[model samples]
Target: MERKSSSSMRLPPAVQAAALAAVGGSRLQKEFAWMSWAGTVWRLEGQSGAVYVKRAGDLKDERDRTVWLAGRLPVPEVLGLFGGFGDDWLLTRAARGVPLSDPSLGWEPSRVARRLGEILRDIHALDAAGCPFGERKLGHVLIHGDYCLPNVLVVDGRLSALIDLGLAGLGDPQDDLAAGVWTLQYNFGPGHAREFLDA
Candidate 1:
């Protein structure tokens, strides 16, 4: 990831103050490579630790789902959520892992595919008895709605954390399965999709 001085970008005053308070410092770095139309992500490192701040049009859904999944699965801790300048800023402690999309990690294709399948299975197995979002239908189960490679983090070759929960909720298992297959193919090539689905 490319890091640029935070001064290059401008954040709403209230959002900037909240991020500074959460990180306990004024030093901030922006991950320009991760910026997208959906939102912009920044990293703040300080004596307290490293935290990530994401600014988007709205993040209440992500905050709510992440909080709901706290004990059930691995996810970043919600440090703070602030709203200002017609945008929502979400602050979360950095997860301890690298995204599977990082090619420099040198992960083997077959192993990565299998691991992704295992992690997705674990997510789907969670009971959704009282899940606040998504319709409670007969076959619904908890799912990582955007189960793409970048959303999954790997540490020591094992699944460590899942992020971007804005679209997560109780839903058809196929939704995650299909996304997993697509991401595996997109990242590792066509032959890995079947390995992921069959793992």
Candidate 2:
């Protein structure tokens, strides 16, 4: 993500205050500007640690899913969620790993594809008995609605964490598999999508 001045993307006063409080008064840097949604992601580094503050039109869904999946999966820890001024702000501790989309990670396509498939398999195997989100259709399983490479993080070639859970819920496993296939093709070129599916 490119670093940009927080001033360039004016956050609502209340959301700004909440973010500051979550990070104990740190400088906010614009990390990502979402194109698919009307949202902005900011990073804050403070004495406590690094945290991410997300501002969106609505974040309650993400917050709820993240909270529910806390112990069941590797995901960011929620710091706070605030709503005001026509926006919702979500503050979470930064996941500790590089996104697969980071070219600097130097991941081999075949191995990464296998690892992604394994991770998705584990996610699908989670018991969905008490899941409070997503429509329960036939053959539905818990899924990460957006399972693209950028959302999956890795450390030492192992899955570290998953982020951006706004679209997570009980859904067909194919939804996640299709996303993984597409991400593999996009990040590592063709010929890896089938490997990801088979692995």
The 10 consecutive residues of candidate 2 with the worst lDDT sum are 29-38
User: Estimated TM-score per prediction?
Assistant: 0.89, 0.87
Off by over 4 Å in 1: 1-7, 84-86
Residue ranges of candidate 2 with Cα displaced over 4 Å: 1-7, 25-38, 84-86
Candidate 2 lDDT over 81-175, as tens digits, reads 88756678888888899888777887688878888898898889989888989989999999999998888999997889999999898998999
- Candidate 2 TM-score over all chains jointly: 0.87
Q: What is candidate 1's local distance difference test score?
A: 0.82
Model 1 agreement with the true structure over 1-199: per-residue lDDT tens digits: 2335543556667666766676666666555436665577877666566778888889999999999999888999997788856688888988989888887778788878888898898888887778999878889999999898888998987878899999899899999999998888887778887778887
